[model samples]
Target chain A: MIKFSNVQLGYGGRPVLNALNFEIQKGDFFGIVGPNGAGKTTLLKAILGLLKPVKGEISFLNIKRGHKKRIGYVPQHASVDEIFPIKVLDMVLMGRYAKMGILKRPKKRDYTIAEEMLKNVGMEGMAEQNYRELSGGQKQRTLIARAMVGEPDTLILDEPVEGMDIQGEIAIMELIKNLHTEFTLTVILVSHDLNIMANYVKTLSIIHNNTLKLGPVDSILNEETMAKVYGAEVKIINISGQKVIISKIK
Target chain B: MNDFLINLEFFKYSIACLVLMALVCSFLSVYIVLKRIVFVSVAVTQISAAGIAIAFIAGLNPTLISLLFTFLGVAIFSIRFTERRLSNESRIGIAFVVSSAAAILLVSKSARGIHEIDDLLYGNILAATPFQIYLMIGIIACIFIVHFLFYKEFTAVTLDFEMARTSGIKARFWELMLYLTIGAAISIGMRTSGNLLITTFLIIPAANGLLIANRMKNVFIIAMTVGIISALTGFYLSYYFDLPTSPCIVATLFLILCLTLPFRFFYRKS
Candidate 1:
């Protein structure tokens, strides 16, 4: 479990998300929904320890000092250079670097775990293929496998389904959903896709105007709350027991 | 050919030194090209040259001074700049120009000004000594061992810097280690191989390998092979043709890279 108490996140001393207070419980499938420049990614960076909070504190309940390896992070797929000559299996093996320790190469067991994660993500056949050759969806899955290979208790995904087709999106979301249950991981996914988040996540956090609205999806995903957060007229309709969000043009 | 063959013993030390230098530079080249730090190499080389020129003027040991200056340059350039007004590339360009100017000025004031400049630019590898050869071999061996030990960390940082940091890999420390290693290599290599040849070795082999290789490991192996082959062939060609060793090696590397262009074309087509 992770807690952000009165946390202020920022760049160059300018607060992006001010006075943020939230707690993510174990085994929770949490989604963060926000518009462009709403500091969703900044919050994730703070959690990952890549950026320190400008003010206040972020504490992991059970994670000890120097044991921050309990959380696995999958940044946006665009964060990497596609042209770099890295193979899928090698990329996944990088996940074991922390556990393998410095100066020690990955062992047979590490490779097996990486392969199993790849298989879980439906990318076992492409392990030997060049990562650049993979499609956007496949690249996302490979990144997920890389994050999951360490067998962390929590997994953080940032825009995992961006730039993918609907089919690819559904496949990746379903894969994450299954991995959450199978691996018993506390999942925190950040995206702008309200419908997917509304249906897939039990609890959702909507970041707007440097504030957070956190609760169950059904309680926080209404049209009025979404319109206020997104600054657009929005509607949430139930289709086949799934919430579909549509934003009206001005 | 008979004259060259007769005096091959005199060329032995230079050949050994160049081949070892080539191996280290070529191996380091993969990271340089992939990380897009070619200009940093240029700046570091110029700084080392400036250090040598200053030593010449001050009557100090050139190797120690050059290493010190190169480490100074590395320290400056390796710092991650937060200011957006001056980008890293622009800063490196400024460093390159300033260092080159300083070298020229200092060399002009020295006793062997023009000769020293020529040696710094093109190198005098043909007159290398056994001590330099042994020193180069030792330094290169240490670099290779360190790289072998931290290979995964290097690859991870080069491939995805942010991900490596988030994964608790001490990305900055490893990156600094990489830059320092390159600094040491360039400084030592510049003593015998000269600026132009060392820079070429640091770039062309990796560029050639990246052109043809589909995997990272192959890229490294191909790069080292390209470097050694170029060094050996260039040494022979220079001996047979009565040309400069450094230029010949650089020319050979350039030609080899050009020859691999067709393979790249075919690769993209397939």
Candidate 2:
């Protein structure tokens, strides 16, 4: 479980996230939905301890700061230089940095785990391929595999499906779903696409004006809530037993 | 060629300088190359050059001024250009433009008798003094110490800083080391290779090394070897032809880089 109570973070002096409170429980596939600069990424960074909250406390399943390696992260794709010369297999091995210990080369067990994780992601064939050469979806899968190699209790993904085609998106969504069930891992995803969230995740949280509203999809997918949160009119329609938001008004 | 090769002290100094520069800059080259901060180093050297030029103009010790200005540049980068604010390349570009402009302005305003800043622009490695030798040794030791102390942190931060931080490594500390290492290299090597050519030693060798090697350790070794070879060949070629040493060295390194491109293609294909 991850808990953020009264979290407030800012740059220089201005606040980005203020009086923010959210808790994620075990086996929860929570999708964080928010507009740009809604502090969704900041919230994730806050949870990861990448940014310290000036006013609040964050506790992860009773674990302290140094012991949070059980938390795996797949940051936004924009954050990394994909043109880096490293191969796909090498990136997976990097997941063992915490366990490999400082100054020690990754051991045989590390390689074994890395190989197994790549196989799990169906990227075994492209193990030695340069990271820069991989297609967008494939790179995302490889990154996911890298994160999963750490075997974390909580897996956090910030827009893991961005820049992917429809088929690629579905494949990744399915992979995440399978991984969540297989590992019984708590998954936190930040995305702007409401349809993707409604279809794949068990719960969704909309972040607006530093306030986070989290609950089941059915309860929170109403017209009033969408209008209130997104400041846009959202017409919900049942299409072949699936809830779809037909259009979002200005 | 025979006359230049026969001078034992020249040979010794050139060889020693080549080895030290190769070892230090080869390791650094990859980080700068991967980070795409070549312009940053260039900008820093220009700024440091400007600082030195200004100090010379004002009748102050240029080396002291250069060091102070280098520290100031590092500090500015640390405070204003966090990983969040700017990519390493953009930050370096900003530094490059500002410093180069400042250097030009300072040079233009100073009296003709003020020390020629061009020497600092293109280095005088063949005429390196014992003081410069000691400075090189000190810089090399610092590089080794910094790399040894923060080997994992540097690798992790270089590869993925956010991941490094999440893994409980202090990324900012290692990043500071990287920036300091670059500053130290420029400060010590600026007199040897000047601002214009220093980046060549810092980048070319490492890039050539990366063409053949995949791992970081192998990359460092291969790059150092290439750097030494180019430096030696540059020294001999310049001496024999009675040519400018720094540009000759830079050209030799560039020639080698061009030669390696075909091998890279063949290796990739195979």
Candidate 3:
């Protein structure tokens, strides 16, 4: 569980998102949706401690500050170089590095966990495969496995299915959904895909107008909020009790 | 072969120094190439060379001077550039050009003049003494131990800097450590192996290994192997053909890299 108290996030004194107040309950599959430059990634960076908040405090209910090992993060796939010569298992083994401590090599147990994580992600067959050779979907899954292999209390995924095909997106979303229940994980996902975010997430936060609107997906993802946030004519259709968002051309 | 045996005693120290320097540089090359900081090595080498030239002009110890200058450059370069106008690459490029120009000017003004510059650029490995060999071994051993102890941290930082930071690893600290190690290696390596030879050793073997190897461990092993093989064979060729040891070794490394191209192609296809 995490609480942000009047948090103001920015870079170089330029505030991107201001006066943010939110509390992420444990085991909640919380989704943060917003337009480009909405400071969603910045919020994630603030939570990850990579960027300091310009103002306010971020308090972890169960974990202390500087003890971020309990939170696993799957960064945007584009952030990593594909040509890097790392094997699948080695990339996954990197997850256990925090627990392995300094000067100590990974033990047999660590390797076993890494292998198990690969299996969970349906990448056990490719453990010895070069990571660069992996398809985009496989790469995303491998990254997810890497994040989950650490066995963290919280999992944060940024654009997990950004460049994937529709099938790839569905598979990844299903995988995350299953893993969320199976592991009882506190999932925090950031994405621009409002449709998937609307259907999957229980609670969603829309960063718009330099502030956050937090509520259930249905309330937060209506046409009015979507138009206000995205500056586009959008329609929210209820299909079989699931919310489907479609942007209309001007 | 008989000629090499006849001059075995003379060649022994230089051979040991080259092999050790090659091993160390090859190991660090993985990080350099993987992190895409090959230019940083070039800039650091140039800075170290300039430091040595300045020391030569001032009649001070060139090794210590070079190390200090290299560390200074590393510290400055490691700081994250806040100004968006000047990219890190542009900064490094400026550093490299200025250091190279300074080295040339300083060497031209020194007593030994251009010949000293040549020696700095293409080192005289045949001139290595047992004391220098011992120093190489000691320094390389320290670097190896440090890398071995912090292998995971180094790999994590090189693989994903932000991920490492989010996982509670001090990415900046490790990055500084990486730059320091590279600085120390370039400083010492450039002295014994010269700038051209050491830079080739720092880059080529790692590139060759990464071309053919899929795994990180294999890449390291293949790189070290390439380095050792190049040094030994190059030493023999230099002895038999009456060539400069540094250039001969670098040429051998280039040849080996070329030879691995087909294998890389085949491996990728498969």
Candidate 4:
């Protein structure tokens, strides 16, 4: 688990997210939701240790001394180098680099694990295919496989299916939901839409105006919180026991 | 016919040096192309050229002067600024333009060194001394050895930098190491093989390899193969047809790049 006590995250002495106090429990499928430029990424970056806090510090609760918690990070596939010549399996195997020694290469067991991950992600058939030619959904699956291959305690995905089609989005999100259940892994997902994440995540942290409200997804998905987060008049509807937000800025 | 080739003994040494330089530059070229830092190479070369010119003006050793300038250039290029006001491309472009001007102006100040500067761009491969040859072998061997030892780390950083950092791979150290090697290679490569041939070897071969192979390992193999082939064929063509060596090498590389199109076309279809 990770804890943040009065943490203020920022860049260049300018605070973006202020007065954050929260803890992500072990094996929790957590979602951080916000609109564009709402310091959501700043919070994620701080948690990832990519950005230092301006005020308070983040401390680990259950982590061991002198050893950092291993995190498997899956960035937006669009942000990756597009022109590199890499196969799907090769892309996934990059996750094992940190686990092996500096001079060590991936061995048979590593390949076996990588191939198993690819199979779990439903990409076993395309392991030899060029990564550049993959569809958005397949690429997302490959990226997920890449993240999972390292066998990290925590998996962090940043907009994993932002550019995918509707079916692809559902499939990837379901895959993530199933993985969280099957592996008993701590999953932290970042997205701009609360409704898209509401059905999958157990807990939600809604960031707005450099402020955050964290609670169970059911409590946080109500109209009042959605309006405050969006700065708009909003309505919440129940579709198959799932909360969906309808907002109008006007 | 064999006697004629044997008589061209000094020519063989030049060819060996060219092939070795090509092999070394081609190794880093894959990273350079994949990282999309082609402009960084251009900027480094120009900054190094300016250093050579400045050394000539100051009566200093050109290799040492240029190596220092190349290191400075690498450091500047590797810095990640918190501010986003000026894009990185703009900064590199500014450095390139300024260095180019400085190289011309500094060399103009030392009129006698102008011919030597021309030799720097076009190279004097046939005139390489024994000391230069030995120095090149040492540097080239070290480059190959370092890459062999740290290739996994380098490939990890190049493939996905943020992922590497998240995995606690010391991405910045690897990045700096990668740039340092590239800087050293450019400075030394330009001196012996000329900037024209060095730039060609640094970019075209990797690109050509990527056209035919989807696997990174295969791409690297093909890149080195392309470089060696061009070096040998270009050297022979220069000897037989009485053409310029540097331009002949560059032309051959470009020709091979063009020739790889069929492979790409077929690969796409397959």
Predicted candidate 2, C-alpha RMSD: 3.6
True contacts kept of each: 0.70, 0.24, 0.74, 0.76
Worst 10 residues of 2 chain A by lDDT: A60-69
TM-score of chain A of 2: 0.93
**Residue A77 alpha-carbon offset, candidate 3, angstroms:** 2.9
How high is the lDDT of residue A242 in model 4? 74
Per-residue error (Å), model 2, residue A55: 4.3
What does candidate 3's lDDT look like per residue over A1-250, in tens digits?
Answer: 8999999988767789999899999999999988888889888888787878889999889776666548899987778887688888888888889888888888999999999988888887898887888898999999999998889888999999899898999999999998899999999999989878988998999998899999987778788888888889998888889777788987
Residue-wise C-alpha lDDT for candidate 4, range A6-63, written one tens digit per residue: 9998777677898999999999999999878888778888888887788987976777
- For model 2, how does the per-residue alpha-carbon lDDT over B170-266 read when each residue is reduced to its tens digit? 6777677788887777777665667766678888988897787776677778788888888778877887888977788789989999989999999
Question: How far out, in Å, is residue B126 in model 2?
Answer: 3.5
Ranking the candidates on lDDT from highest down gives 1, 3, 4, 2
Which has the better DockQ: candidate 1, or candidate 2?
A: 1
Across all candidates, the chain A TM-score values are 0.96, 0.93, 0.96, 0.96
Compose the digit string of candidate 1's lDDT tens values, residues A118-170: 99999978889998888888899999999888778989999988988899999
Instruction: List candidate 1 stretches off by more than 4 Å.
Output: A64-66, B239-243, B267-270
DockQ measured for candidate 1: 0.62
Q: Name the regions of candidate 2 deviating beyond 4 angstroms.
A: A64-66, A231-233, A238-241, A248-250, B50-72, B79-115, B145-151, B210-218, B260-270
State residue B61's C-alpha deviation in candidate 2, in Å. Answer: 7.9
